[model samples]
Target: MPNYIETDYKTDPAFFRSYIKPDLWEDSNALYKEYMSWENNKFFVQVIKQFDKPLLRQIKNIWNYMGIRPKEWRCNFFRVLPGGNLPLHKDTMSKISVVIPLTNMTGELYFEDGTEVLYHNMTIINTQVPHGVKPPTEERIVFHMGIHDTYFEEVKIGHNS
Candidate 1:
């Protein structure tokens, strides 16, 4: 199967942009300490907690529309600083992620198979695959939802429509 699949579902990037603030973000290395060894515990990436109920509701609605039902709700804002890149690695906690680029999303999403995606509206990415981000000209932020307990095949079928 493909490493990633684009979805028709789209949301207002402005809504997410409103929450962006320097103080709101926390170093991703601190949040996922277990994965620190993979990247030498670098602090290039940061994350913001998802707190807005309405935003969560909207994400849930989109999940439903895409025929995906997560066992639990987990959402966060992932920011990769300019000149920083996430080393190629597979996620252990979740197999799939719904990524919606919020700002300066010109970075490349590289997969182990040599496929690359430069721009995307909304996409479902296979986190189980070895993938990483290439440094971008500017900071990049994406709304990420980690989906568990749902088969990727089923989600792919929904997107195929």
Candidate 2:
């Protein structure tokens, strides 16, 4: 299978202003404990548990646009500081993953073959392969949604994990 497939789904600035803020990430310890296996403690992620009506509507619209009908899904709001970086890993609980950039900062997603990918608003990544993020020169915020993977297993860590 292909490592990743690009999608035409773009991000809505209005939705970013409405749902993706620092406050939404403040109270997500329970959700994080359940889903993510964050190996590097340097990165900060806020799991969005209680989505607002408008945000939910917008997410629904995105799902429709992607032509995906998922029974359940989860969103993680990530904040990577200038010097922080996440190690290479694959999604264990998510079948499909979509990352939406919420900030204008420069960052890069590097694949196993050492190829670097960058985008502004939205991008779709194949969580089944080994992928990692490089620290941007400035603060970076992104919206990550685990669309369809349901079987949560052990947390993987590092480039060889």
The numbered model that scores best in lDDT is 1
Instruction: State the lDDT of candidate 1 residue by residue for 48-136, as single tens digits.
Output: 45467877678777787767777764677778777666767787777788888998676799998898888667888888888888777
lDDT of candidate 1 at residue 102, scale 0 to 100: 90
Candidate models: Cα lDDT each = 0.73, 0.66
Candidate 2 runs further than 4 Å off: 21-41, 150-161
Give the residue spans of candidate 1 off by over 4 A.
32-50
Residue 147 C-alpha lDDT in model 2: 72
**Location of the lowest summed lDDT over 10 successive residues in candidate 1:** 39-48
* lDDT score for residue 150 of model 2: 28
